[model samples]
Each structure stands twice: as structure tokens, then as C-alpha cells.
Target: MPVVKEAPLLDGSAGRLVRLYTVSGGRTRPTASLDLLTLVVATGSEPPPRSGPEHAQAMGLCRGPISVAEIAAHLGVPVTVAKIVLSDLVDCGAVAARPPDSFDHPTDRSLLEAVLDGLRRQL
Candidate 1:
């Protein structure tokens, strides 16, 4: 297993900022269109030779489909940072991304009720 570097907190600290910058290769924006709800999965392709540790770690987490928000949480990095890393993997064909399903009627009462019922059942 490749060693993944610990993600630094985005606490407005200089050292943390530097590490984050390093992780993203100084790129502030991702080329791929991604959101918190976007689902990413491993494509079973190896990362490029020059890929960073974050790429490897992200790939490991992506053995199954996982949301971008979950990836950020697991990686201990900010959502933006996760997006950057995921975008790179996407560009390299090492990972595949699925946009979140769109709901035609987001305000449907039945949907809300179903969600509430599911939550209640969990509790």
C-alpha cells in the first residue's frame, strides 16, 4: 500500500495553507464539474507514475461509489481540496465520477415524508 500523507486542516494557518497548496499542485480550481453530492468510484486503473499520495488514498476510498463530501470527510481535507484531487484522478482516468441524481420535484411532500420516516426508523 502506498503511504498517504496526512491532510492538513484549512485553519488559515500558513503551514496548513502551504501543505494544501502542495497537495493540489498549486491549482485552485478543478477542471471537472463536481459537487458535494457527486459520486466517484475507482476505474480499476492505476494512477499515473507522477501521481501524488492523495491520489492513491482517494483511489483506495473509491473502491466503491462514494460521494465527494464523504471523500473530503474521510481525507480530513476541505471539500475544495477533495475536488481538486478527484478532478486530477478523473483527468487521468484512474477514477470515474457520477453526478448526483436530479430530482424533478425536489419539494415533493412524499419525498420529504419518506426521508423523515427513514430517519425516524434509524433512531
Candidate 2:
């Protein structure tokens, strides 16, 4: 049930602080990241959960720009836990962010096959 706010003029990456303006002339700051990964992590609430050793350990476990959900999975904690950590990091500017140009995810093969099969059946 995500409210599509006319698809923000400036699309951004997860775990980074970004400034956005609403269609109604209101400025929106980085309250929190909200990608699919973020949505899973944040559990659809705020200010967010709490950060602890698990977050640090997640940084150690994963070398890349880690998201809340990824960190949670690595630490065997809930995504909620990881998201809190991410929110703290975002506030502190501790996490590095990949540019939007690199915003690419591998396609899910099973989903792709399902769609292809449906198309073939229709044809």
C-alpha cells in the first residue's frame, strides 16, 4: 500500500540521504530510505528501530554498501533491527551510498519464466 507521490522527480538509492520536493511545493528531506529493500527493512514505520552491535557486525560481514535488510539477514536479526541501524547511520552520515546510476538489480529468473510462460500460453 505504498502511496505513489507522482514518482518523485529525483529518484535516489537506498541508505543515502536525499532531498526531495513534493508536487505540492513542500520540501522533503531524507526521513529514511524507501526502496523495496528499505520498505522490508523499515517495516513501514519510523523513526526506525534501534541500532547495536549487530549493525557493526553487519558492516564487517558485508563489504559493499549494505542495506538494512541485508545487514539484518547477515546478523540473523530482524529487518526492523537493521533498518534502525541504517537510520542512525544515515543521520550520522556514516554509510557510503552508490550513485543512482548503479541502481540495478538482477532480474528474478523464476518470475521471468512465469511471465514468459503466461505470454506463451496466451499466444
Candidate 3:
């Protein structure tokens, strides 16, 4: 079960303010490109106490491969911010990330164009 707690009310602009403050704390983000679908697995047990709540939550969630988007959603943070945090964990060797299995590059553009043309004609 998710641990639910009542948070103190914040002013309307607190979200951005909080993100800016946390990100400015000077941890360098990892070089790995964290895509929405990239698979992440925990490489360590529970993160050390100083690693912060997000890192601990990520470690717990990543016992199996989980997507960056899901992690971000669970953490209630933006994907960009999550990537930065996850990257830090990766740098600490607490997690392993794998890019998506399918390549985005088109193998045959002419063949794709031909298929598109046929579909267009049918429409």
C-alpha cells in the first residue's frame, strides 16, 4: 500500500518553486538519456538515508524493470526532473537503465512512403 500523508497546504506557485529549489541543490544529473519507456531496475537495496525520499521510493519500485514515466508519476514530479534524480541514482550505481528494445530509425523510408501512399489512396 502507498503511504499516504496529508501535506501542508502550499501557495499556488509552490510546485515550480519546489522543483527549482531541489534541482539547485547541485547534484549533477547522469548522462544516460532517460526516455519515458526506458527500463530501470534497482541495482542496490534500499538507498542510504542521505539519498532522499525520491531515491528510496525509486529503489523500492525498481526491484523489477519499470518505466521512467511510471516512476515520475509515482513520485509526482515532472519527467525531466525525474530523469535528473534517476540519473543521480544511476551515477551512484543504485540502478540500471536500459533503452527501449525497438530502434526509432527507419530501416526503409521508401517502403514506408509506398505504404503511406497506398493508405492515402484508400482514404
Could you say which candidate leads in lDDT?
1
Between candidates 2 and 3, name the one with more favorable TM-score: 3
Choose 1 or 3, whichever is better by lDDT: 1
Alpha-carbon deviation at 27 in model 1, angstroms: 0.9
What TM-score goes with each of the models? 0.72, 0.41, 0.63
Q: Give the per-residue lDDT of model 2 (tens digit) for 12-115.
A: 56431222121112323334563425422222222324434444554464355445556666655445545555555555555543323335766688998999
Off by over 4 Å in 3: 1-20, 23-30, 45-48, 104-123
Candidate 3: residue 63 lDDT (0-100): 90
Which lDDT tens digits does candidate 1 get at residues 21-87? 8889999999899999899999988889888777778999999999999999988789999999999
Winner on TM-score between 1 and 3 is 1
Residues 4-90, model 3: lDDT tens digits: 984532357654334533742554454678889888999864555587666777788899999999999987777877787788778
Model with the higher lDDT, candidate 2 or 3: 3
Query: By lDDT, is 1 or 2 better?
Result: 1
lDDT of 1 at 59: 92
Ranked by lDDT from best down, the candidates are 1, 3, 2
Candidate models: Cα lDDT each? 0.87, 0.46, 0.75
What is the Cα-based TM-score of model 2? 0.41
lDDT of 2: 0.46
